[model samples]
Target: MTSTDKYIEMKVPAFILTGLLCGLLLQPVAAQTGPAHNRPNIILIMSDDMGYSDLGCYGSEISTPNLDSLAMTGLRYTRFHNMGHCCPSRAALMTGLYPHQTGLGWMTGTNFHLPGFTDELNEHCVTIAEVLKTAGYATLMAGKWHLSHNIHAGGPQHDWPLQRGFEKFYGILTGAGNYYDPASLCRDNTLITPLNDPEYHPQHFYFTNAITDNAVRFMQERPKDKPFFMYVAYTTAHWPMQAPEEAIEKYKGKYDAGWDVLRRQRFEREKALGVIDKDATLSPSDTHPWAEEKDKAAMARRMETYAAMITIMDQGIGKIVDELKKEGIFDNTVIVFLQDNGGNAEGTGFGGPEGETRPVVPKNAAALKPLGKDEVQYAINPPVTRDGKRVMQGKNVMAGPADTYLAYLKPWGNLSNTPFRKYKNFVYEGGVATPLIIHWPDGIKAERGAVRTQSGHEIDLMPTIAQLAGAKYPSVYKGNEITPVSGISLIPTFEDKPLPPERAIYWSHQANRAMLMGKWKIVSGGILNGPYGKWKTYVSLPWQLYDMENDRSEMRDLSAEHPDIVKKMAAMWDKWAHSTNVYPMPWKEVKPPLRPDYMSTPWEYPDF
Candidate 1:
């Protein structure tokens, strides 16, 4: 029978939900042979700032055998996208609601006007944890938790993972920090010490390793009969790109060619591998002319460190997979891997708004120089004491003495974003588009190695997981009412069904707003600074449109030629924005602007 027909035949009536568990438990052994609600265990793995071509399966030359192994046994997605930043993308992924609906319409730093001065997850939404946990799955979270920081302030409320529906939580609370001595590490709601495991030889202090260790522990200790939902988020490959000397040494000379050459090569390789369209145009360089010079050695060294970080993270993933195999649960687990956002260009030397906070290690005076970036460069040799002891200084080189601190320079960062036009903070594809991989050994019907063209977004993940587990999301969770999920399931793609065209995908973070309908996209150069300040908070406009299907690089603007289409799409987009609680202007604007807020801005560079 067809899936819909089967659903109609098997769906329990509203009256049955209350006694469902009792009925299920009382069923005879022979009658319980079928799927227990199609409820397979769910494992979601997220990487940080990973590039489009950073995996072997995606055409990278880096050592990503583990990821490649997963691709060999499952399905790969080529056109999936995120909202383009961390908190926003994560909000969409977890709650299945648009970022605006979750009150994190922009990155935490955007300062978009909200009820409080904090940038925390709103109480109006439901998390995947709350839904799945209620459905009888044990939910656990590990890695970076940027949902809320004020939770630790001992205020009116706390917003850590436990408070948000997760049964177990561990990881950093903020956006960025030192990998070794991160500023914010928590168990439930209390602070903890850094990675000071003397038992582990040579003091191998790395967040990637630590997070993975926690992942394995959780799985090994989980009840075999109870299904699980694990969110394994890793902070590797973001900023503060530090790696072991041996790992960095492997790619020491790999990026000798400047970003221009590297980008074209990676794009061509990705096309050949079917990771992206063969005709997809590469986005143009967004850095200044001075930043383009070929510092082959330095550039290669920087990418080497970056590559090392990814490699290490992959190794950790392998361990987790191995543990599942040991428990004989590998075949039934559904694994989804993705990135929070695109590669970050805010180098280790970058600071403040341009650069997020990174950790600093103490160093001796001789080992110190002007702090270049916020983190350490893997290539730079660590300072050694007169006897030969390696300095254990933290990041943020300029703030302290030797053996006390260390930081990376900015040049390495220029290489991290590589071919992408903009850095982590912008609204460009470089900052938004990310790698998404899905693997299901026994559930998915698609060929093991097939790569589908259907477009997938962060919002789609929730609905997809819900459908897979046959879990019902409630209208209210944790005493707060919730908006229904906005995404459709991807099971259709895996089932080989015809995919639908892009209907309407709108974006707005700190006035960096954009809208995509079918092949056309509209973007403004700036946020919240438009003409006459109508939508006065988002005063940037002069709607530029790009046929994404043909102009994936977003080079040509057809707004003037297709004025009719632009107006129609613009109206539809504005309607969506308003419905989702987006401010007509920046949250800080004193006066509200006209509806639809389409006004031209005075300053704009190419590709906003």
Candidate 2:
């Protein structure tokens, strides 16, 4: 374990402690398994549908002082990759394996029933919670737990957080939804609507605050003798952009300058902050000019809502930090913050308010009856509000209200992922790249605010936590043969030792592929279909290569000049795809299991 694990270790010898003292120390100490070891408490916080440069530390104009403070004294990683989307990213992060190995190559909603595409987390893989809990860490999870396929109340709960090793769980079963009256919202194993949840009744029921509050409650009531591990997954800044009106008002007129100017501004700030290469050129964008926009006011208002969502999350992070400090565990707690994926460019309610399921409502409808305390909210996108207001969306309908549902759209997403090329679900830097900030004052051997240029991936998290807790990763768990971890511990980086080069990093989501080997990177995203004939698939696309040392933004394609290198990397990617159960993708043969339809259309950029 790094320098921080000593905080919670109870190593008082029986011979040394007198009669009554022995009982007091050993009573709870016996709860933990394994040898006496220093195990730092870990808090993993993840934001949904955010961008690489969205944090103030990462050069955004948004107010994120809490996250900025963490970055100020923490170690920042410049070349970390997340899986292009939430499902696979979370899978890789939790299991220390590629997504396909966890039977989550696709999303939880899709049950291809194939090797790589099972509906829920498979038996072969163990979660970070399961591993840490075995070593006596009290595991608590707050926020989205979208790893299970059967989210319906009466459906099977075999794969929910409680079964997966979390001692306490308070969050949604499905992914993104309304913050005020979220669907699939639950406490522990029982599903309940926010309006009637008996245990928690804040002045106002906001999801972000609720998530952090429950986490704080867990910490407060936790057995102080044992170390703890928490996963705080916040669904902020995702589609159906909603926040407290006052929070949204904080960023009013923030984006009146539009995406082009905003993107450029963030680029300059990132360079100045040393997060990006000072000499790196900002990647170009396809956003409309601010002056010529027909709905400049609406776009600005939408961005304000998005910024507010992030700002609120930042404030929640501050609350989490404050609690840690109050509990006197701040120095020994490892606080990690990263986004699930880059900014989403889905065309959610982009055009009009006519998109609601119940398009028309009585102008002044009677108030809807409140559900029973134990009744569950089943729909992620409900037809009406808890009080009978019809849920509406569009350019005319303002965002940041309970009755409104919409995303900020692509132009703002372009600004969110400034100096990088695409949005979520693609393998380009903009799609998969996210800022990773880690704070462990007692354990970090590197200088404060140090930036590491070495490349890392979500898979690295599992092994890193394993080393921190000194927990042994199982070879065979519950009779199922477990897959070996594909990641190495990241602790070495925190201790000032640079990671050796030459390990290949692989990624494939919806046929968008990338492989990074040393300074060279090969990516192919032109087609959703894997390369046909040669890659043994029905689709084809040429591989584009880049020298990452120079073109971190992926602006320069060196494929034609380095065909040999491209061919070699493509061959490696093909072999990996086959071995990792990425072959026989369900898209070609198996019909996709009915998945919840959430967005209108995915934002597709030019294919040049």
Candidate 3:
């Protein structure tokens, strides 16, 4: 009132002066300060369908220098876990919630009208990007965006990357496709033609390269005023194993000894590297022996191609790391590299559908051309045309060419998981365990080249990023009440501090179930076929107990000896499944929406 009186005396308009004073008083606190220095940029890189021991640092023969370098400078978590499959692991990683809580208990293709089977990120959850963006971070995503079901549909996709709070997005919207011409390639919210389109001469288009290029571009173009969050989800080393001929050539004759020898070699190396305990016994091979293989040359070639795919991915990572260095942000950037799940065992050993009797084309065939250059199509499962015509998709073609679509299959997949008992889609250590490497030059002051033996899961990533970025998880977001994040932050482990002893991690995929309470774990699923395959029915499978502290490879099943422990763990898992929207397993037939006709265009059906 005194100030207003003074202003009136000075012949100034009281209302105008008061307005000016109020504006000065209400100036934002951020306006008076400099940018936040403690907030670090986050780069979360994930490899699709990669095994736990595929990287060189993790005891693989694969040339992954970039990832290995990252491991040397950063901290490696020896006991990190995935959700035993791609979609669920991804959903868990992005939302900091159980996959079921994020509405992806099943894959993206199916929407069974169940709480956890919606095939899209639910309204109750918030992605890392969404949460970080609210804290003034520029969120970007590159590579696969398999969180939504209708990615191939026309119009602005409601659950696309941009809509999920990514400031910029460049990647395939579907789960998988050809590396040369990926399906549903998009920039931001708009679908675009592949970079190697006919207009571009001498096309050098590759999925991994394209993903890395866009990631670097985002870093270069981002606002300097804000820290950033980037999710670089690479689809390399997944399926349709294709790589540059030169890269494949580099691994020639490397796997000639076959999986029997290779698995043992890798297990020994893992022990030497301290990635796995020396006492950890290698599991007996459920796959056929190397001596029993008829096409040793072709099998070796497939492994070579698989190695090439990983090497190329590593090269792309190198490029991105260089860009980070050039941007002067490498020191503060938090780089987390991990795989989505264990290796796949989907195809036959001879470069086609499992149990196919078709003859495979030799690599020397003049008509075969070079692998990874031509467009190869193949039928994988229930191999047939839409109108019930038998199609020759996987017949008589060598893998590693664009004209050939083949997975490395069970033999290689068994090798890839190394010492573990099963491949992807199971609850065993082979399926769920993954290597997690975190590098933060400024934040992590612990010993370099050190390993953290604590058990962590993909769900821990979002909470870890939130803690590192000083971002708060909102209780309510955009008018919807959000679910609490189900992950515990791994910040304490970065400083070599011990994690809490009582933390429990749970996993459920396609009826395969597991629970880890302390060092005790109870698992209930394995391979889906053959004598060793214990996976039969979803609901009635016997729960097997493992003292994880002693048996990391899951060679022994202690369910009978520890019935009380198994009972307790099973009850706990049931409680988690019920509370987390994981019930009503979508094992029944669910007719999904008609996928658009993209085969004429570059898109192809995923080999899930």
Best by TM-score: 2
Number of residue pairs clashing in candidate 2, backbone atoms closer than 3 angstroms, sequence gap of 3 or more or interchain: 2
Q: For residues 515-537, what per-residue lDDT tens digits would candidate 1 score against the true structure?
A: 76555677655545443223444
What are the Cα lDDT values of the candidates?
0.64, 0.80, 0.76
Clash pairs detected, candidate 2? 5-38, 532-539
Ranking by lDDT: 2, 3, 1
Better of 1 and 2 by lDDT: 2
Top-lDDT structure, candidate number: 2
10 residues in a row with least lDDT, candidate 1: 24-33
- TM-score of every candidate relative to the true structure: 0.79, 0.88, 0.83
